[model samples]
Target: MASAALIESSLSGIPVKRGKVRDVYDFGDRLLFVATDRISAFDWILSPGIPDKGRVLTQISRFWFERFESVSNHLLSMNPADVPLPDDADLEALSGRCMVVRKTEVIPFECVVRGYLSGSGWKDYLATGAVCGIDLLEGLQQSDQLPEPLFTPATKAETGHDENVSFQTMSDAIGQELAEKLRDLSIQIYQQGSEYAQQRGIILADTKFEFGILDGEPILIDEVLTPDSSRFWPADRYQPGGAQLSLDKQFVRDWLETTTWDKNSPPPPLPEEIVSKTREKYFEAYKMLTGKECTW
Candidate 1:
């Protein structure tokens, strides 16, 4: 039998705020973030969780979070013993997929940075000649590298899809200074990650980040640089003007597209082949980037 999915986590001390992929339990001044194997696509959490998916996601986040200590992050520890788990909670189940995190007032927007023309960015560029209201050079292909990474911020919607917005629109929502800081930090992080992933033969096409305020200082909150939050393409096979094969969740998304189910409510369960292939992709990314198999 496959490993049991950690879809919901509840502890004694505090209330839990469940997101699309994480089960977050408040810890007074901190929080326990548990990466669940439950895969979400087009906003719906798919059934029959992919085994080892949560561990891969959590470990990947830990790798980047440690590598970039120069930036303030919410992570405290990935060790289960360090977390404030309830007496009844399953210790073995939570071991590798959980983190003890510093709690903060989370920033409202998704700090997205794109280094390539793809996905929604490509669609927007083809239609408006810009992304998030930032104009780009004309005649750019579908996967062409942008002049530079663009900080495309979007609203963090509770339900439905996230709406992309202009930098000016972000500034209008949350002061110009704060907006500028987020944009700069986002671009800087993406640049460094792109460089690093490229060295490992993976194209860090684009990624989104979440931030929050801790004692009046902006800090990185939530998972960073995981396959769920970023687009990772094999560098060797990367080509412009078309879709690139990815080492992320794109495999599953591509499979889903073939199904007759509408992109509305109640998505169909993934086939065994798709599940296994996607798990392999996630693990491949973790191994390729960290140079070690996910022993957990």
Candidate 2:
């Protein structure tokens, strides 16, 4: 089941910026998003891309985008066959991983929500008895489900760790009104997604969503809750006061922690076993949530 990993798309379109995962191409009024199999850890894009990673990421995102239609998003189409490209451009590599979307002015902050205590949010809570400056009751152990979800926003970083900022700081940076809107929408989306996933035997511990403004109205953009952007733990094995097994990139992160490679600088390449297992984790998340096998 080793599928081709498209580290980069060969399709031709007006040039746009490339990110750690998706490469975007400008097409006049629309944009083309090609999610590659590229995987990044500690902010470094590693070598030997995971097989079929792009297909899983793109398709899982499409499932969430379609399910959350109540929240307007930038998505236009996910079918590569329907996406227009220049003559002679090969789209075989982009199948099931391409999105043609309406372009908009992207908001610069990360809209994050946490249903469970984990990751950096756990670290923040341990030190401050609060996460993102929101006071929480003490004695909340690691991986413990929060009494209620909290809107914790971070500034998206280009080359380093995304700095977690308080709601007041976010309001100071963006207008208070706009900041409040993003917070509300982020919580709503996370709660709904978490509830659905819980019923399906997955715990969406936390997830991030991006939004952009189209004609002065905020619309969800970028990738919404994918394994790369969220922490998904299997419900059956869930435990508190410690780390939980996840079907997300955190699995790779846990492996990386045992390595001699420092969080800074270039990351080491993944072994065949690691890559294979990681691919299974990603595809399984897609299958478990969407209830359909990836066509690839």
Candidate 3:
């Protein structure tokens, strides 16, 4: 693992905010979002970093931003030449992983939309017969496609996992009008992304979106449509029963499940083979979904 100082030396300065996998540096009115090589599983940051993980995620997000521009506006300048990067900076080093974005006040909630039953939704359904406060028909199996996509809003927790909240709770948090707008826009974005992925032989099972307010208008912020934010399954192998193959970090999760390491403690380090395979999976997903090679 790279030391914190080593990571900091690679950047212009220390990050203003350090998340699990990305680092954010304040750059005047804009921000530099740098995706690191770190990999996390079971909500824990593991050892033995995966090479090019950042690049793969960055490429995936960039591809989606371009693809969705016809349907909605994203906070992207899309001009590498205009960015105020250091003269001696190695842009290639940051390839497939970094973005210079206009800074905006992020929303308080994580707008999650689901088209399939799995993960927390499946657990919630099995336990309480509801998912994000939406009741499902009895006998819905894992990975079963829902009749229609549903907007399952959640409150963004400060330092831990987010909690699913009812629609009424969301409305109370952000007012009825904004909540309604968020729901509508979330479902619209999901539908467009899901449909596009389906055409490319990938099933966008579900994904979470984050929005920010800029000039009193809501604009998409953070990464969009990446494997980190959504589950991608190969269309050819997808079945209504059993667990669906993930297009992203499914390998890491599978390895963790096999070990006796408790989810509460830090996850074990990934072996070189697992890291390489995971990186390949990410690249394969990008190529399959966008029909473009991941040059990085």
Candidate 4:
């Protein structure tokens, strides 16, 4: 039997900040991040969340956090029980899907690094020959690898798609020194992740990172390099002319495109088959990347 999905988490006496797929509980010195099974596409949260989706995401992030220990990050503990919780809190539900992290003032921009021409980047290149103000060579097909990875920063929107902006724009909003540092760091991490994923027979096409100010220095925060934040493609099935199979929520997006519902309205509830397949894809990514089955 399949496990019931956790769409939302309600803890007593804890002030929580709920995003589309995660609930962040404020705990004075630290924060508890609970990844729910809720899935979103076209910026709309869909119904009937995928089973064990949150566990896969949280575990994958934990794997990367441990692997990148030399890198400064906000992860303090993976055990939610380490922090205070209500007497009625469900430890079983939170076991594999929560993180106790140092609280930091989150930066307002998404540090996106793209190594392939796809999605919005391909669309932007087709129309303007540039992506977020960085010009690329002509004649590049969809899914084609770029000459070099580009650090494209985007404004973090609360309720809609993150709008891509130029590096200069990011510098203007923040500062030149900080912006340059984030750009360099974003590209560096992307390169390391991409190379490693290729060895696992998966291609890390693009990814976005969130950073925060911790004790006067920038540290990586939020979910790290998971499928929800990065594009993962099977190396054996890749082609450059058009869309390739991805191991993420792209399955949900593709299914929605086949339906008549306009993206302006709330998305339709995902079918059972779609939900199951989506869950399988997320789990497959976790296994391939970590070399361990997603037991959670």
Candidate topping lDDT: 4
Top model by TM-score, which number? Answer: 4
Whole-model lDDT, model 3: 0.78
Candidate 4 per-residue lDDT over residues 172-224, each given as its tens digit? 98899999999998888889888889999899999999999988888999998
Where is model 1 poorest over a 10-residue stretch in terms of lDDT?
Answer: 1-10
Tens digits of per-residue lDDT, candidate 3, 140-212, equal 9999999999899888764567888888998997889888988999899899999999999999999999888
Tell me the tens digit of each residue's lDDT in model 1 across 1-296.
45766666556666888888888887688778888888988888898788878888899999999989899998888876675567788777887888898989888899999999999999998899988688898989999998888888999987668889888888998899999998898988889889999999999999999999989888888889999999999999998989999988878888888989798869998888888888889989999999998775
Which should have the higher lDDT, number 2 or number 3? 2
Candidate 2, 11-103: lDDT as tens digits: 554576788888888777889898889999888898889878887888888889999989999888886555567787766777778888999
Clashing pairs in 2: none
Candidate 4, pairs of clashing residues: none
What RMSD, rounded to one decimal, does every model reach? 1.4, 1.3, 3.0, 0.8
Off by over 4 Å in 2: 81-84
For residue 235, model 3's alpha carbon misses the true position, in angstroms, by 0.8
Which of the predicted structures, 3 or 4, would earn the higher TM-score when compared with the native? 4
